[model samples]
Target: MEEIALHILDLVQNCVEAGASEVSIAITECRRDNLLTVKISDNGRGMDQATLAAVTDPFFTTRSTRKVGLGIPLLKAAAEQCNGSFTIESSEGKGTQVVASFALDHIDRAPLGSMADTLAAVFAVHHVDVHYRHEVDGKVFMLDSKEIRQLCGDELMHPRVIVWLRAYIEEHEKQVGGEQ
Candidate 1:
């Protein structure tokens, strides 16, 4: 993926497929620390120890469709290439968490990309509850799909509403992250 947000979308989609009802995503950009971290946690049917161990292998996947699963491996490579780290943990009956960090100013670190579009795409399809938080330095912007469902009566799939949500998220992202 050319963008971190796309990677995020792929990871979260996997969680959704795994029967997640709630997902939490956090992005922390700390320029002072020269780090960019992305964490995603989902309340879903997590992997067994055996599966977890093989998760980073491109040849292993829970899906029956294709032979390869590249999301996790790609993210791992992306992080390591940027002089950072990647970690994933899961419990069979509990959930899963994946965290990838990148050197904030690394020459090869991918752009964060349009979180607005990424999130809007999620809401457009799945009804999963999503809590997303983005922080740059000390500034923060958050979006809760459940809260929006409550306030807007679950019209997030509406075309007009999706447009509004994307624009809203983009504006907040620019404000909190200081112009992308």
Candidate 2:
């Protein structure tokens, strides 16, 4: 993916496909450390050691719809190309967590594109609850879909609510210096 947000979208979709009811995405940009880290955790049907071991292989996938899986492998390569690292932890029935870090100032580091749109798109369609947090330096912006659902009640999927969500996410992204 050309943008880190696209990578995030892909990973989150994977979590949804795995039957996740909740997902948490955290992005931390530490200029002092020259690091941009993304961590995604999902309460989904996770993998066993054997599956987890093969997740990084571009040719391996749990899906029958496609012959190859490139999401995880591509993300790993993106991080490594920027002189950073990627790691995943999972258990058969528990959940999964994926972490990818990139050197913030690396020449090859991808931009974080259209995050507000990404969040809005995911939130609008998926039934899963999501908690998104973005931290730049020490400032943080957080958005929790659970809270929104509670506030909106049965109107959670109303058109106005979706618009509100997009606007809210955009404001937060701007506050955290992640506006695209």
Candidate 3:
């Protein structure tokens, strides 16, 4: 993918397909170390060893909706191109965790595109709880829908909150990203 956010979207979609009710996404950008890492964990029906091993294969997919699987394979290629790595671990009854890391300064490293927009898109539509934490250098930005629900009460789904989140994400994208 051209942008890391698109990769994130595809990975999270896998979580949803696995019957996840809770997903956690963490992005840590260490500019000084020239590293960018993304970790996505989900409390969903996980995979067997065989399935996990084949997850990176373009020809292997558990879904009947499509004949090919390019998400994980494409992501793997992207990371490797940047002198990075991709790893996935899971337990059948427990959950799954996917980690992808890239060399920040590598010429082939893909852009970590509007990440805030990616988070907002995942949160607004899923209805399920997601814990999102972004760390740029040492600074952190956190969004917990459960917390929002607690504060907003029955109005948790209010259109205003969604709009506010979208605006907040867009406005402070650079700040949250440590670009400024």
Candidate RMSDs in order: 1.0, 1.3, 1.9
Where in model 2 is the C-alpha error above 4 Å?
none
Instruction: Compute the lDDT of residue 177 as modeled in candidate 3.
Output: 62
Model 3, residue 87: distance off in Å is 0.5
Best by lDDT: 1
Tens-place lDDT per residue, model 1, 89-174, is: 99987899999999988999899999999999998888798999999989999999988998888677898998999999999999
lDDT of 3 by residue, 9-38 (tens): 889989998999998989899989889898
Q: After superposition, how far is residue 110 of candidate 2 from its true place, in Å?
A: 0.9
To one decimal, what is the Cα RMSD in angstroms of model 1 from the true structure? Answer: 1.0
Judging by lDDT, tell me the better candidate of 2 and 3.
2
Which of 1 and 2 is the better model by TM-score? 1
- Give per-residue lDDT, candidate 2, residue 151: 89
| Backbone clashes in model 2 | 0
Model 1 clash pairs are none
Model 1 — which ten-residue stretch has the worst lDDT? Answer: 171-180
lDDT of 2 by residue, 1-180 (tens): 889999999999999999999999999999889999999999999999999999999999988999899999999999999999999999877899999999998999889887887887787788889999999999999989899888887677777788888898888788889425
Q: Judging by TM-score against the true structure, name the best candidate.
A: 1
RMSD of 2: 1.3
